[model samples]
Target: MEQPWDYLRHNDPAAAGILDALANDRTLEDIDRARILTAVDHAAHDLEIRQRLTAELTTLGSAAALHPSGLRTLPGTRFATHNMLAGQVRLGRVVPTANSALMRAGDFGIDHDVLRTSLMVIGPPGSGKTRSLAIPIVEHLALASLAGKASLVVIDPKGTDFAYDDWFDITIDPLNPTHGFSLFGGATNADTAADRLTAALLPPNVSDDKAYFKDASYNALYDCLAPYHAAYGAWPTVKELLALLRASQSVHDQVKAALKGTPGAKEWKEHLDNRVRQSQGSHDPAASLVERLARLDRPALRKIFDHQHRFEMRDINRPVRVRVAIPEADYPEASRVLARLVVSQFVQTASAPDTNRRIFKGLVIDEAGRYVDDYVARGVQKVRSNNAGIVLLTQTLADFPPDVRPTIFGSTGCKAVFGGVDPETADHFSRWFGDEWITQNTVSRGQTSSITYDDRTIFTRRSGHSEGHTQSVSSRRVERARWTPSDIITAVPPGHALMALATSDGNRVGPMLVNLRN
Candidate 1:
């Protein structure tokens, strides 16, 4: 007949204090409550005390509930509300139960701080991977931006997925010169510009032979840009860079004669001579590099990067939404180049020393596999402390090359896998979520016959026979994955996904189902 709080007060006064705090404080944040509950859970060794604490905690919010495995449970709406109230950016809601036919409010959600380590959302086309996950998160971030709590930068390579034109303050279209945005605005020196340009031109995995040529091309490009920086004190336009790459002798002589006493003029002249000599050879080391850079010579790309627009790295510190829309189908080659440029620029901006960690800055790349490289992966690893987050949406794990896939996967702290994923990718998630003990039931059947003659009866009457059957059933625990690879393929429905989130305490909460809020 005694109350749970009374028992806590009599036995464990510390847990009783936590309960008293929860009951008295009307404005206690969910995060603080979670921290208090975690402390209580650790302090209470007795099973009854823990159960009482969990019961009391659940009344605070759905997120207060704990899984049987002792991990805290967060429902979707609660997760979103917790983050929004706490000023953290929302990713999506979490559905605690898996393979459910219906969804409800108060589901768990992922936040920006959790995603500062990076996030990977994998599902096939038409599987609601974008609609249910990426878009929703982007919308939430945009809302946060509107409230002056955060900023957003979305790289839409396909250009069709993001429909919130009204939400973004700056919309950059590489195909439209009128909406121009500079990729080199963040480059402080010639060397940084060269590195950014090199990453934009080269893919993630370049052949050994191509790597040598890339280095040569980088040096040539650096020299060409060094003069422009010395004279103008700013990065050169795409048109200027292209002109230098394909410069004639007279133009070269003019640039050299004009900058004879510059700091890097001597080195630049030597590199230029080497490039000129190499150009005459049958096997030009910079031939492939030249061809890749030539893609930027198109009227659309040339105009886009010709002049710097208003969007810059410092804009992330303010409340702004920068949407980069590149249509891949219309300009396949140019799209790849532009996508790489935008992501690389973000990495450079995030890496700068003056970046503001107090404001939340996010970069969302839909169909990221088309553009992700080692630079982006390394950025993901380093951006956590800078108060920046990245969300990469890809159709499949196979979209990333073999060598860089592990780096991308390893850098990500959370992963949401939706339906229609292949067996191999599903198996990867299964292993990532790890194993659990499952109850296995075994049943056996047998038949037995016994013939007993009445001892008092004579031998002539001892012809009676009887037949009997027996059945036995038993249950035991076996270790197995909570969700098998096939379970993902067959059980997960559209608009639903299995999310495995890494908690702040370094615990993985769920590979549980999450219902996307429409």
Candidate 2:
């Protein structure tokens, strides 16, 4: 007259332990116990199997049900943690069944380590790229800051998108003088300062022939600033630099004569003389440089450049949030220059040596394509060792120039593709994710009939047979991109994205459909 539990105890101890736990649990109702017992019966075999079943049963019993609009959070691993939750491994409830429904709960996420290498997020307007991906990232970094694990810097060129002012400790308004940060901070020498200023003033899209003018302008600025720095032990202000650019002919001659004996001055003089000779023909190259820089001569921008409180690159290592807000609509040229300056500064800081690299630092650039240049590319290539991460957001591959697209794609270890992407961009991601072979199923049908004996009479008979088969074809093929460019353009709904995470060895883990939690 032994009970069923007793029978299991004598034969299968694993099963018996699960049964005892379920039966003795006070929280589970009779119906819940019955359901769990049925599942346990189906899974009762090896000890490992029983333990896994018990864990799942426990989850089912106590876990909150997911809403239709909600996607289960990605469980934390050694590389990444849930921003709001604390746990070593939090398994998501979403399963990728062949017939899975849209917006259903699912577990999909990129590794935190991959993020350190770099990340690119692309989607058209209103694709939830910012909310689902960027905002969550920012919140996670903020949480990490509070925990003393990381620091963050965000560049919001548009200004209006990031309204969460409370999340940041410092807000730099490039359009306001009193509350702005200096672009020339941390420059060790006059040459460095002049180079940064030149880069900021250079046009975003410039032709090859025009490159000489930029170099010549840089030389002129350097020649003027070098003597000033030597005499005063500090670099010139924006107003002072402008004054040098507007110097009278006699003043230019006097400064040139003064710097005649200085190192590098001879080369600078030659560049200036060449620029002057060239200006005698078509458009004046030096004048063009002056006009371009003149855009920053306005009151608001001048205040930003002349601000006394300069921003230091090393400040990013502290547990704080720094936001560089650029009012693009009001001052597009100045905004671009500020963005470039910030990127250059961050790159310079990241390139420095660090004794303890455990503290993570992040740079989040919204509309990043506008700011990416050779310096940023080089930084992405080297920042992984410094415990720094960069998150770049853009609408499409077209947002980047043709030459730079490869460097950006090659350096980034993680890519998240949202909906409404063009085919060209989708195809690029498709190829980047690489290719695989798949089974091709083929079906065929045939019929044969015969009639004989009485040709004189009218008699007929027919028979037919059908055949179906699946072939394991070895044709080289691309695994269908989780979301084709077409799929992104037409099929992807809001709040969901297709993500591909890469390992350290450069192997891709998934192009899974992830439902972003708002």
Candidate 3:
């Protein structure tokens, strides 16, 4: 019935023929004006369609759908079953794309390549940022599991986001309530525990001012490591890491003295006791400690067992990435530190001769705006080229320190912004992308002189554009670009987003609505 696709194959002779073909179909005349206008608007505005048409279509070649392979790498959220059209957009289903999958309701054929530039989904609390990101984490891990690869490293601030309890043949471990000969103490047999402790205690953020953390706080470091040793039952499991820390802490007494302090010693002892109490409520201190450590370390311990490789040993099949989620309440600083450490260490580990093959490790830090703003900015600026991607999530502009927003956006290769009603955040973001679009119009009326005046309908002149997030990157810089009055009024519920890609050839790909979950 003279559809958009039909225009490709007809211009003059064929156009008349197509018209004739549709002439017999009376129903074809009933097509809605609104739908036809929408199509025309899309053809005019959507950059992806424009590029494809320019590149592939000639006088002879038309009517064919644009292939998805042409999509250049851009950060986005993907759904399992592509939601090509609206599916009862509900608050519960509305969320951001957590990891790196971008899906639209219909089949646009955008290539689902392994994401390069990491994603940062910013919104606000209850904006569904975490859940949106978590789905991708679980799905990506599942894909890795299927491929017989370990591809995810989750450093959860809450520790319960992605439950791998029975899913991956992996273990879940929390560092807490452990006691006895500490790894931070440098006991020869406790060397392994010391190493694990070192790995655990290595702060994610390191400054020149606090560079001597290794030597300045040995006992505090030990207390931090205590949770790990307690979790593993012995320090030997992480011996090599201990050796590295030993070198760093060679002259440190802060750790030793801190451990020896009366209160410190008592707290340490009681922590050990709590481990035991967690198990079966034991009377014996050591026994109680053992049980408690078991409970806390069980997950991490189980993960170790599943790998079929010792901590210090190497395995070709071992997953290079691992995600650790610890509640902010348990060890807030540690969560951020662990995130930083893991990224830095993985990059370092990838270059090390023996571990170099395990080079492609990544870390996804959710709600990062609350904790590691500066580190995230620096990490995004430097890490991607090293084959290490860091995906950070935050729900609001206020959630992050205000001063770093420009740097954060500048350093990030991929930027994703979800829903926020706040004009401060949304409007600030608009400057980068464009603006939160609002339609404004002035309709003139014709008047007739009667007893009063008769109202006459004049045309409504439309002005302004739609608002959505857009990403721009060149050889020299990166920024979040927005579009003003980008398009018409399209109602997008949660879990949905309009994305735009600025590729090399002066083409702006979209501001397409993409769905990440179902």
Candidate 4:
């Protein structure tokens, strides 16, 4: 007779070793062995199940690789064991400790479906927003990336936290001095490169009446780069691109002379001609863009955003993990500007049609409120359908522009609110959770003494008996916010969070409390 363990010994060594370890434990119960044997039998026939079982075995050890792919783990970070083939990692279980009826004690996480719609996490520093939510999500995607399932791009302004350089394929660091980021976003298309650069350079969240600034900046870059690429057969460097953008009539004449007799000379020349005409205006779009671009174009950053030896966002089409660390300490303003560039490029790249539609793509921006604009807010929903999603971490909604926060919040499918947040952020979550019907129960009890008399007829009314007892009970359904601002602000513990999730197919789980720790 061949036992399950024997079948395992003949086929998979990893599973057999894990089974031996499980069997040597004297504390194992009959039911535990039965489940283990059953799992072994299933795992023999299924490779993913086998991988999950081996990963599960690590739980008994001092350090566990929590990712089911068995590809990697984040040591010192708390994680749960779950089969992530469905694109789910159980970060924590739900806890029954909130006013909302939607919440219950159970396993909770955002699978690929919920993530495809996008995730937004709000919490203050030391509130586990990064350790518990953002990094774990990135780690989960990292494991998926290794298993040939998905791709991820993480842009961290703080830079040091996500030091998964060992696992990732490329690291784009402005301070690295060698490997760096592309100012032009490595876009093959001229308009795309121009749009990405312009988005990164343009001030975000402009009002409707002032949209000309945004439109003009986009047009100016495209006009220069499109003709320039057609003529030069390559992307312009910071110096060359800046000159074309900040062109005086002399510079414009040189640009025009270079493009003369080109294939699209007529139309390209006209486009450049329009840009030169606008360069003299009171509110020139190119002027504003050049000003912003030049702000970060310092001598210290020359090698970082260079055209050569730079990481391109276009490489994300394959399964890869890219980290672009912005040097906030030295280049404070450049950090913000480059952060916008990374996000703008990410959104643009993710939104483009991919040949491998099934491979999921993710973008994680720690402290995203500073750089994410109305463009990302507006385009995320469209990005969701393109098999990509973004994970945003913010201390408060206040960090973002007032005009853009609502749209940003509204666009994401998953919103996780952690403790220690400000009243305004809590208040927004409270209202955003909206109203739910709750039964209100009331009970009244009273005693009327003999001295009591009716108010309607004081003199004529008879006095009450020695004592009269009255009791009443009533219950009615009342509408109220599922969770109040006070609850969102004070009630949630440090390690726990309140999350609402919506699946890609439209199934929704209203805001529920979840414990982020193991």
TM-score (all chains, Cα) for each model:
0.74, 0.67, 0.45, 0.78
Ranking 3 against 4 by lDDT, winner:
4
lDDT of 1 at 192: 80
Clashing pairs in 2: 75-90, 94-106, 420-488
Q: Considering summed lDDT, which 10 consecutive residues are worst modelled in model 1?
A: 451-460
Every candidate's lDDT: 0.69, 0.63, 0.40, 0.75
How well is each residue in 55-85 modelled by candidate 4, as lDDT tens digits?
7765543122222334343344434454444
Using alpha carbons, what is the TM-score of model 3? 0.45
Candidate 2: tens digits of C-alpha lDDT, residues 496-515: 66666665456665665666
User: Number of the top candidate by TM-score?
Assistant: 4
- Candidate 4 residue 496 Cα shift, in angstroms, is 0.7
1 or 3, greater by lDDT: 1
Reference-based TM-score, model 2: 0.67
Best by lDDT: 4
Better candidate number, 1 or 2, judged by lDDT: 1
- List, residue by residue over 368-404, the lDDT tens digit for candidate 3: 6655545446655454444445556776667767676
Return whichever of 3 and 4 wins on TM-score. 4
Judge candidate 3 against the unseen true structure and give its global Cα lDDT, from 0 to 1: 0.40
